[model samples]
Target: MSGLLQGIRIVELASWTYVPSAGAALSDWGAEVVKIEDTRGGDPCRYLTIGGLDPAQSRVDANFMMELGNHGKRSIGVDIKSERGRDILRRLIERADVFLTNWLPAALERADLSVERIREFNPNVIVARGSGQGSRGPERDRGGFDAASYLARGAVAYALTPPDAEYPVTQTPAFGDLQGGITLAGGIAAALFHRATTGHAPVVDSSLLSQGVWAMAPDIAAADYYGIDRIPVGNAGTAPNPAVNRYRTRDGRWIQLVFLQADRYWKGFCERIGRPDMATDERFVPLANLVANKETATAELRHTFAERDLADWQKILADEPGVWATLASPKEVLSDPQVVANGYLMTVTDAAGREYRTAAAPVQFDETPPPPRRAPEYGEHTEDILLELGFDWDAIIAAKEAGAVL
Candidate 1:
């Protein structure tokens, strides 16, 4: 990965998605990230079996899940619990610009890798901590996953789930973790700027809970102001503005119109949809009249849209002032013309040399995204990193023999 942050060095001592995600984003921004993995098999996420994917279902049997947060980092296996391993880490930390971790507070204390100890190795290096709950709460020491802290404690489930439903809707896989990762990446970038300006590095922290709160900030604020949890979810047929709802097409596709200012485009929208009569009809002229007869207006609009497929409607309203978009399915979105034209998605090879499509980080530099490389294999860069750290071949061999490194 090469773009901005080209000379930045990040020592990533974390596993799984939450914090590693920040490292991944930093790597995407052209940072030199060195992932320090444990000696056994590296990050445990490398071997995790997801709920629905089966090895036999695919030809490559590769771990795409692990690749999400790891695709551009170099991996070196070291048993940091050992003295020799800790010594090797110190040497790396001494040269690093950022020390990133997702270890729990208690875990840091137990492993003697606390922030105070880390500062002793490099006073000016930034310490970026990613966690599930937070650093100062009563539950700070308690471990948490995104499901526990983000969806549950952060009120996301409550905000999303219907009151009449038996169970709250669960988040799609790693949604919260990925959001947290991107948020943490932004925080680290800000910390870097702060360091450059003040001559002192500030500790950066972000968490799944923080991200969840941020995601629902608008809803939370509305709730606080109105003294209510939320306004009830409205149905398309009952929408106050017919232009602000979705309608089904002939081929069973759905298209949403987002005309917040309904009156401004009401006539043009009706003309484009081959319903000029409705535009002149007194019952549906102004937005207030349309709302008074919403059920009827919705039915007429749905029937008019059903007369044409998505392709026809696309052309009919392609240049209209009204904002409209097709409700694309997961499969349809991949081949969307906008996605292809903008280079939002890309293909990258994995460690096993299998080519797979992955999404680019949201931001771009010079209208270009960083090219991704495969995540390193376990201990793949052990000798190279050791040599870089000024260790002789003999010393490297000795450390391996003593179980300090893989």
Candidate 2:
């Protein structure tokens, strides 16, 4: 299928994951996203340090994180602080349908990239801002990363961390940023609809904090209603229902079972475990009996599971009407049969033909996977973009001498 946003134009004045990720998604869906970078070094994410080691230490050659948040977009390096560069941005904004940014409100105003100034160039353009917090608040101008704003402030880390842990669990890299960016992209899509229908261009706001709240809504609601900060989790032996927790297999791998309706699957589960007789035992016969003797039942199940490897259990539960999954590691997921079959990951080839894989946004159109595109090199298309903007070589030379373009 063709891209959903085939002809849409986005001018992105953003760096890092939050706003740039949204630009990537918009570009993925076939928008023309122009990522405006500074004349020096461009986005910092391109040279990201992973776990105190250089990106190449991860054993992947490409700048994968940058590709993750910035692929499928054109890069235009400009010194936005310069008068000539500001004029260049004005020209780009005049032809754009959306102006997207992640700068702090105060910083944007200081840089002359505020909504009011943007409207002076394209009055009908949609202005979208992705921030650490919403535009209005005591900390509006305060800086935030996904770890601080989304996980910590949003209570994600608080809710997910085990009560016995010394510190709250840290979020995986850019986990919240990518999700929030996808959501922001959806908001931009909605804004486009609103503009087309009402001729009233609206300013769209999305934040890491709000995305966290949305993700943890049910947990937040339950915590508030129950007057609790965090709900504790029980292990297999202590779980109220033996079927609702993880158990280790003989091979040291684990499987998670979540049979909420234990009554319906009790006998079938026992049969799959090669212990049909246990289904009729007084200790586990009725659902209530199983709950009363949960520890014993859990022990019995653990013993049974320990008799088999994860592969053996996989075959035993292949067609069973039960809810369970083998715990796959991050590396294992890359070769997961279902993920491969569904095109969840695609190969992205950089300019030098170096290839790496990246996941697609969850949403798809017409069952067609969005084609992956490599991120631009530093100022990859700067001169071509200038030419398209109707600037001559003399102006380019002046901008180059003045350090206006990278």
Candidate 3:
């Protein structure tokens, strides 16, 4: 089926994992995404992990970059510092429906690619900006990333580790970056839809800090109501709930059993595990009592869980009313039968004839399923794009020789 964004064109002037991932998601939905990279080094991610290898070959073979953010898009190398490059972008913006970037305010001002400038080129273009904090704030100029956003806005410090643990655990990967990307894509889609009906461009502003706050709204709300400082409970839940903790199985795998309504399912769960007598015990009878003695209840649950393997526990809990459980791991999740049945994994071939698989866009449209297209080669279509922009062949060749295009 054709994609919902089949007719949209996006010019992505963003790099790194965050903003690029947003553009990639749009491309997966059949948008014509042209990722503009500098002719000098292209994206820093291309050479980030390829060490002690030929720069030319390794930079071009940025497998991780391709997997994470370049899928289903074309790449164009241009020296945005040069006049010719800026002119090229201006021409492309005239025909583009969306422009995305994660450059800081100062950087955007320096490049003259600010929202006002872009609007001058294409009045109906949706401009989306993803940043660390926001466009205006005391910390607006401060450098922000997933770590800073997590620490500052997500209240991650409160839940960094178990209260009894010696030290806090730092999260790896760019959670803020990923969340910001997803939020940016959604904002852009909304802006585009609005533009389609109103014939007026809109600015979509998103930040890692805002996204982090959104993810922690539940905890924030709880903290507000109880007037109690939320602390790390580790495997236990924030609320006084004993049934939502993680338990270790016989095979050393952890199973997260989340049964919020223990009063409703405790008896059935006990019968399923051949421990029905425990269901009627005074200490474990009422939900409040169980929560009051959570430590003891957790220990008993852990011991019971350790008596069986994960598969056995899964069998016992499968479709059990009010009891929800799952074995956590990305590897296990990717191979899940439900994921496959829903066509969430897509396979695409690159220019090098290598085939790889990637997850499909999360949102599923009833009438339009997105198509996966190969990412573009570095400046592969530079000449063609410049010519289409009304640049003469002589000027294009001059620009190429001037290191303005690769």
Candidate 4:
């Protein structure tokens, strides 16, 4: 069966994970996405090698990072600074249902590719843009990357770091990029839907900073209403809810329990851990008493959990009434039965006939997902695209010779 966005076409003039990853999502949704890059070095992400993996080890033209961001898109190398290149983009925009870019306002102005100019080519086209910050502000023209704009500026870094740590802990790679890209794709989908019903094209804009703030909106709003500085989470002991805590197993593995309804689950939780005496103990019988002696209770639970391995605890707690899960590493998740059953991971083979597993998009339809496709080589479809744009071989050769396209 076809994806939800089978016939939609997207012209993406963006680079790096922050914006191009949205094209990846669209491609997964079966949109025909054509990624336009400069003829020189192409997307800089092509050289990225994660976890110290050698770039030369990659079977595909791009390393895993580039593939993860740009998969299933047609690649065209065009120097937009040139008149002929700009004309090519205009023609592509004319035929496109959506135009996506991450260019700053100054860069857009310099290239004469503003929203108005883009709409001139196709009045009904949806102009979707990704940015580090909003379009208007003191730093509107400043270029943005996910780390600087999203985590740092949006209060995420401040909130995530442990208060007692000597230094702030680092966030995972592309944490904000993936989220921001997904947000942009969702906005684009909403814009398309709006246009389909109202026949009015709207500009869709998404920014990492905005997304970061939105993700923490509840905490920020609560802080504002309380007229106090945000609280720092130094450790499990500092967590507002004692029921929500992590305990170490005898095997050194960690299990996190989050039973919000503490009163309802207190008896069962204590009984399952073979600590029935603690549940009846006057100091811990009532929820308020337990909270008042949180340290003692947590220490006792930790001691109890340390008496058995994770496997033993898993079996003992399986039928107990509480919300809990083992802390799993990425490798563990790769082999997780639930993830496998849901098809959250997929396999793809590169041109060299090498097979590897990759993540599927965070969506499903009719219990199925789109097959993962490898990213294209640089300018892989330039000739075919030029032909589709009504340029014959002679004309295409001339453009290539003139350095307008690759």
What lDDT tens digits, residue by residue, belong to model 4 across residues 9-67? Answer: 99999988988989998888889999998989788887665675677775654466677
Judged by TM-score relative to the true structure, which candidate is superior, 1 or 4?
4
TM-score, candidate 1, is 0.93
lDDT of 3 by residue, 1-80 (tens): 54778889999988777788898888767688888999987887665554454546632333654566777787788998
> What would you estimate as the lDDT of candidate 4?
0.85
What is the C-alpha lDDT profile of model 1 across 1-406, one tens digit per residue? 2469988999999988888878888888899999999998889888877788786786563566667788788999999999889999999999999999998889899988888899899998999998988887787887767887898888888887766677887976677888889889999999999898998988888888888899888888889999998656653234667778889899999889899887899998888778899999989878889878878898899899999999998899889897899998877868899887777766776547777766666777787767867667778899999999999999999999999999
Alpha-carbon local distance difference test for all models: 0.85, 0.88, 0.77, 0.85
User: In terms of lDDT, which candidate is stronger, 1 or 3?
Assistant: 1
TM for every model, in the order presented, reads: 0.93, 0.94, 0.90, 0.95
Q: After superposing candidate 2, which stretches have Cα over 4 Å from the reference?
A: 52-54, 57-60, 235-238, 285-288
Deviating ranges (above 4 Å) for candidate 1: 163-166, 235-240, 350-354
- Clashes per model (N, Cα, C within 3 A): 0, 0, 0, 0
Q: On a 0 to 100 scale, what is the lDDT of residue 171 in model 3?
A: 58
Q: Report the lDDT of model 2 for residue 59.
A: 44
TM-score of 4: 0.95
After TM-score superposition, the amount by which residue 167's alpha carbon in candidate 2 deviates from its true location, in angstroms, is 3.2
